[model samples]
Target chain A: MANTMLHINHIAKTFNPGTITEKKALLDVELTLNEGDFVTVIGGNGAGKSTMLNAVAGVFPVDSGKIEIGGVDVTHLPEYKRAKYLGRVFQDPMTGTAATMNIEENMALAMRRGQPRGLKWGIRPMEREMYREQLRTLGLGLEDRMQSKVGLLSGGQRQALTLLMATLKTPKLLLLDEHTAALDPKTAAKVLELTEKIVAEQKLTAMMVTHNMKDAIAIGNRLIMMNAGRIVVDVSGERKKNLTRAEVMGLFEKAAGEELDGDRLLLS
Target chain B: MEIIKLINALPGCVSQGVIWGIMAIGVYITYRILDVADLTVDGSIATGGAVATVLLMAGVNPWIALIVAFVVGMLTGLATGIFHTFMGIPAILAGILTQLSLYSVNLAILGKANLPLNATKLELLISQRNVRALSLDNPLIVLAIVTAGVIALLYLFFGTELGCSLRATGANNAMARAQGINTNTNKVLGLMLSNGLVALSGALLCQYQGFTDVGMGRGAIVIGLAAVIIGEVLFSKIFNNFALKLLAVSIGAVIYFVVIQVVLWLGLDTDFLKMLQALVVAVFLAIPYWKGKYFNKKTGKGA
Candidate 1:
């Protein structure tokens, strides 16, 4: 009886079709997330994991199928239009925030997402205190440097800021595409912890793509594995809660009919 | 080189620089804020002059003529924007295409290579004859007031939410789109605003010189860029405020003209002035790139 936050039905995508370097990135991929469900996605290289997330985010049009967020058909909506219903964090730290703008300006832009931007002042004086409060919660001491340009921030700090910006409006679905992959180990762990806390605090429906098998099994309430442009394994509830890395690998091997070949995935 | 002659010319040079400084502010919007090197200024400036001249000759009010020129100039930007965004042309090429097409548009508007406004018969806002005047009729005084007005208006506009979106669109396109900004529309809006200001400068320049020549704006983009680079090189560190930065660009234009005047007085041939201007701009533009490439030590590992 739960509301469905996202419904991606039979989507397929082909990059550079009919060319010498054609790539079938996604094929007949179907996914649905109930309200408050957190799903973690895992796959080897060339699997449709990130593609699925991008598909849902409307980065590109699907070759086939319909996408709906909050029961609104969004199949033909452009990425910016679809952004009204989704919060997304990219793997690259530079992809989420405007580097030249100050910290408060970036947050101000995010806070007005999906709303009509007019000739009124971009950042009101009252909003500065709110931004300071939010930055304080990050515990990175960014609260004291609200006027500092984002380009001066380290990669981890930018990613953390991007995470904060993404969740500021409590989006119906949060898409994290290897958002912590580029950070150092300690920072990655810290960001991951923050991600879990924010998602729980907001009780947001979310999908996360990760290469680390441990994180894939450990974080979310549901797990979906993709390979060869299709979902190869899906486990949830009690089964996913008790799932181990070895057991997930066994399941991937059984479904894929081959050994997991991503060394980075296995090593991580 | 008579010192008295040079002193007499200095005021005129300053007046000319301030007039062109308005055009350079237009250039700053595209080149600095929107991060586009729009070549459409060359054609659009001339278009403004031609439109204003033709309108003035028809006995229309000069102020109304300037406004009409500004609106027409915005149309030129619209053409380039459509070419770049809707038609999928690259930004630089789109500007070039618009510039080329505007050559014919300018000719059609003027009906000749030159159009003159008789300042004696017409009540013009500014003129070169009053360049040395110390009274209210002095072109320098009027131009300074106009330039200050332009900077104040732009400062206010850029602080608005819509303006912030435009700035974000230029700073990081991907991030802007992800934040629900329609970047294409913002880009078009930026282009229109820039070319409108450029055209307004053109109208003022035509009224000041009392004539509009088809070739008056030939190297306009270069001059605008020279002013922008000179301004940033000289004042970027101290002029952190938005209005002050615009003032810097205007002052930069004045410096450019004063330097040219000095070079002219130092026995430089008038025939070689264009080449000298080009060289000055090239060197100024290269300084930052060279500093980044040759002076700075590599600090971080390559990704």
Candidate 2:
């Protein structure tokens, strides 16, 4: 039996509770991922896709549910403490890496994730060879410019570096929140390919949130559709592999009781 | 107008600048590395002097007095850190509050507004009386060795795993947290380290000048900033290494004092020196913003 890597039980989150601007971002969301389960999450604007991911990452406290990663209860743990169990990539490239630091330094930071940072040197001489090998896999020529500041890189390069950094330690779970959404079409496709390659090579359990509908159907072994604040459609195995865009939309409309209203979703 | 008079004052100005260079380095940690405009230095510098002077008067070893001043300075930073991080106050306001309260604290330590250190009777670490001397007692020689030691230690610290996390915390708070670094803890640690150095500088300054005054550190933030900006503007391109960057800051302090001396020699009133320092810093600080706004080449609109 596959071990459960992530267990999010009946979690709910509300932003600015009791205020006029209060928005219910997540409502009774529940999810469980087995080891090596690559799940793709899709939703319209204001849906709870990102909120659910953030809850799992411990970005904010859930109002009334427990989150466990690798069988460890972490519902009340702060973001930094919970970071030990997960790797995260944000939508904006700039949000994932320190611009002022060099590529090797950024990777060195990620390499030490979940470990106590002591008085030891940040990057050992031997570690530089490892970083160089990893950068070579990205094929962006970053290995030659290890000393170059990350601020000098383009958006796609930064996103690729972020992906490498996120999975550098083989995280128990990876959370990608529309990481390629900010890149141009060609760059986005490249990053998506890299993400798929890395996920499979590491045999890592991962959750990816994407705005592209085709990517949702094409990339992961399982597909989950969310509407409002709940999961509406879930399909995996042979059923998920054969899922078409129109059928997914039909399932969403039937479960949600409304036609999808997101123009960006439709156009993409 | 006399060239010989101006030449005679150069050594004194260099010694004062070197001492303040240590304080400016403290500013660089908070301002440049930690990305905080910590105003706590304004009061903590005097707090260092007060603590050191009092200890020296009690027949304590000068080095031990300096160490105590450094520790007290770190305590002041811890107070500001608690206010900013634990209590959720804005960093600037937290610094200001600590600085304001430190005034009373400094006065209490000295038990008066000013305390004089009779250098002839007490064995001092560094004194202006020997600034021009070629012997080991010369303030410049001692200051040079001290400043180099500081730069070497800081370079090593910043290379450590803990130090990199502090730099990441300043460079990008969001990214730092994602990498499992406790950013609040790092911020507090950085503030403490910065203020400890500032207080050490204050101790040295008091001993060198033979007195500690409550108002001696007035406008210190401006002078520190001037030194930092001057250093960056002059040596940023060439001094990319961490140790060299710190060295540039010390050199920048020397240049700042040299400029002030030149102005004074040009018959400028000593009272206007503060105004002059403020203006110079303000102008240097604004140059980057103005260049980014006005000097960029116009790129065509995106497709």
Candidate 3:
């Protein structure tokens, strides 16, 4: 059965009104992710990739339109209310983990997502073992440093920790907003590989926004390219499989009717 | 050469320092741990004292009255967090709003410009005058009670599931949200706890000083911040561990008190203490950024 994991319909966002600086961040944008859909979103700067993620996450009230996850209408819900159904990671390494907390504690927080919190220590003996096994999957040897404060970890290590934490609850949809942008090139590649392995293993519906075109083509079952606050191109299956860096760039130029000048997008 | 003399002159230094220590613990939760500047401490201290004294006047038990003060403090803190998280107000403005409102609340509770608790309220812990023969003037006994209570509570609270989430929220709110921890709730909770503790200290101070003036909390946030920053810079240098920062903060409060005596003995105007506070805080706050930006590569590497 092809169950839909997420649906975005006719969403539009405009900043400021009756003022000189009104700018629209998203416009009549529509997107849908079937169960286990791994959609890679690629666009240049101001392409509304992050804004779209923020809108879906309810960072704030969007101007209009509907967002559904697991067939439930969640467009007007606050971020905290919708949190149980979605897991997220941001671009900055520092944004995703409490730097002062131990690695194990961070994992426990993610594991207990949406559960009633209390004054007791969050992680127990059984939970510790579960966290260790999960950390092992990263192959980053973080299990041995469970008690170590996460702030001490390198950028790559923190991002890897974030990925594990995000999927721990098996959220209905996972949002990764340039989750690897802060890492060095080599570490970013490694983390991306880990992202794929985990997405495949969990079979979780995922949306990832990235600037790198090769990663855009290589990582997911579907590719979505956005520009001027709209989904400019959508590719899947055989067409998506053969997507090249050059073809993605050509479509951006054709849809926007101008050569892209910003360094926000990588072109070959 | 005169450290011992400085300690002798500031008889209330230990007890006063401990009270400041509790407030520092609050400062720590919001500023150091949460990474948000909260200006509510100034109003909250007065709010705690006012609530406690008012409750005592209404015939509430001394201990129970103190708890009431803490509750008021929490509400004030919650208001501050709500401003930032829900109303989209800047964090500083959010704190300022709560702080301004707390001023009127304190005035109403006191029923006058100040509330005198020495005539009305019991000492925080009932001391047995003959049990150990330690006089009321003994600073060690005072420090002992306050320190033990604060350390135990902080250790217990920060170790809990909610506490870790609070710390994580301050450390990185986005990550806290990613993990399904509500940063808004945590922020509000953290402010409430921080101000709650600060006001509890204020209640203690009122009894210790004989009164809770409407302005007693003036410049208090600065004093607490100075103690906290001084503590972190000195302690992190030696302990080199995250968990030990609490202990370091306690020691820092003690050091700040001891230094106050030295400044007093040097004939520095008591009125100028606030200026001295600003200087000390400026130095320590810059220490970490300096150490990271300059000394880390030159001297060595460690956080």
Candidate 4:
């Protein structure tokens, strides 16, 4: 039995509808993922990749269509209401974790995501020990500095901590919106490696949006290409594993009937 | 002789400081923890004083009257919270709207400009008459206990799940929502808790002065901000603990009042007090911004 983990059906979203600045961000976008599937999404600027992720996250109500998570209809759910089933890491490290709070506190928050938060102690002694072990896995020496505020950390450290926070509760679907785009190349590679480790260990269903073409091909079991607010190409299984950067560009051009602009989809 | 006069005024300044210090703690919740400069306290404090005085005059228990005052104050916060969250108004404007409407509501509660809680007829929790008294009835002793109790309760509350959520909401709305925390409800809850303390402080202030005046809280927000800034400047390096931060706020209020006493004893005109207070707060508030813009710029990172 192949259970569907995420179902985004014929969804459409238009920003500032009926205005001068109107943008059809997503038009008839349909996507579905099975349990434990890791899909990589690649697109140009304004290609609607992030918008689709936001739609699934329920950042705003879609103009049309329905979405389901774990076979449960969530089209009308608000962002926070839908948060129980999803873990999200944003492109900007600042958007994923609370800076003023300490590392242990941030993890404690993620550990209880979707759970009823009440008058109980926010972090228990046992939970602290567990968090210490989890932080050690990052190999970033954060375990010893659990009490340090998240604001004091470098961008790479924050991104790693956010990745750990997102998967702490084992979300039904993990959305990574270019989670390492803001970091230096060295740090970016390190965080990417960590992301792979976490997803594999948890057997998590995931969607990763990236600008680097090599990353889209080299990682994830499936690859999706988007252009002009719709998916232009999708490949999975063994085909996705053997794909090269040049092949993806050729596929994009053939499917969209337009040259894949070098600036938008970098081969290198 | 002048030194003796200043020394004689010390006890009164300390007691009044403690009363306003509690109000400052309430301000600390919105200003420091929630990142909101809530002006609702100005009117809500008057509302608390009005409710307490009216109830005390009608033969209610002092403690019970204070509780009622606290509840009413929380209602004012709810109104502002709804305006800001549900109605999509800016936080500052929401607070201002509630503060404006509360003036009429408070007048209706009292039905006059002022109401007296005479010590001769009514048993008070704390009173100005006991400033020189050595008994437990001394306003200083009673207020200190209340301040300590309030700080302890707040410290515990902030360590709880719901409390951390509220803190997270203040720290970052986007992250809080991403974590499945409802930022709207948390903001409203924070507002309610803050105003409840503000009202409680107002109730104590009413009892201490033996009267509740509708205009008593006119500049209350300034006093609260003054206390918060003073506390931050004096104890930010030393008091990293939550409870100590609150205690710093209370002590800050005491220092504020003592300074005022010294200025008065030095023959400054009484009419210039409000302007003086506003000036002091403005300068202190600008210091951080100026430091970041001018002094810290050379450090090579803005963070």
Which one is best on DockQ?
2
Model 3 chain B scores worst on lDDT over the 10 consecutive residues at: B124-133
Clashing pairs in 1: none
Model 3 quality (TM-score): 0.89
Would you list the rank order by DockQ, best first?
A: 2, 4, 1, 3
Give the alpha carbon lDDT tens digit for every residue of B21-122 in model 3: 877778888888788899999999998888877776667777777678778888889889889888989988898888888888888888788766554244
Q: Chain A TM-score per candidate?
A: 0.98, 0.98, 0.95, 0.98
lDDT of each: 0.91, 0.93, 0.81, 0.93
| Candidate that beats the other on lDDT, 1 or 4, i.e. the better one | 4
Q: For candidate 1, lDDT tens digit of each residue in A1-268?
A: 8999999899999999999999999988888889999999998888988989888888899999999999999999999898888898999999999999999999999998888899999999999999899999999999999989999999999999999999998799999999999999999999999999999999999999998888888998999999889998999999999999888888989998997765835436
Q: What is model 4's DockQ versus the real complex?
A: 0.87
Q: List residue ranges in candidate 2 displaced over 4 A.
A: A262-267, B300-303
In model 1, state the lDDT of residue B182: 93
Q: Which residues of candidate 3, in runs, are more than 4 Å off? A: A17-20, A244-264, B1-8, B55-60, B115-143, B239-244, B296-303
- For model 1, the superposed segments whose C-alpha errors exceed 4 Å read A262-267, B295-303
Error in Å for residue A104 of model 1: 0.8
Task: Kindly list the per-residue Cα lDDT of model 2 for residues A1-268, writing each as its tens digit.
Answer: 9999999899888999999999999888888899999999998877888899888887788999899999999998988998898899999999999999999999999999988999999999999999999999999999999999999999999999999999999899999999989999999999999999999999999999988999999998999988878988888989999999889888888998987675935427
Query: Which tens-of-lDDT digit does each residue in B54-110 have in candidate 4?
Result: 898898999899889989989999999999999999999999999999989989999
lDDT of 2 by residue, B245-275 (tens): 9999999999999999999999999988888
lDDT by residue for model 4 (A1-268), tens: 6799999999999999999999999988889999999999998999999999999998899999999999999999889989999999999999989999999999998898988789999999999999999999999999999999999999999999999999999999999999988999999999999999999999999999998888888888999998888998999999999998878889999999997789876445
Angstrom error of the Cα, residue B238, model 4: value is 0.4
DockQ, Cα level, model 3: 0.64
Model 2 earns a TM-score of 0.98
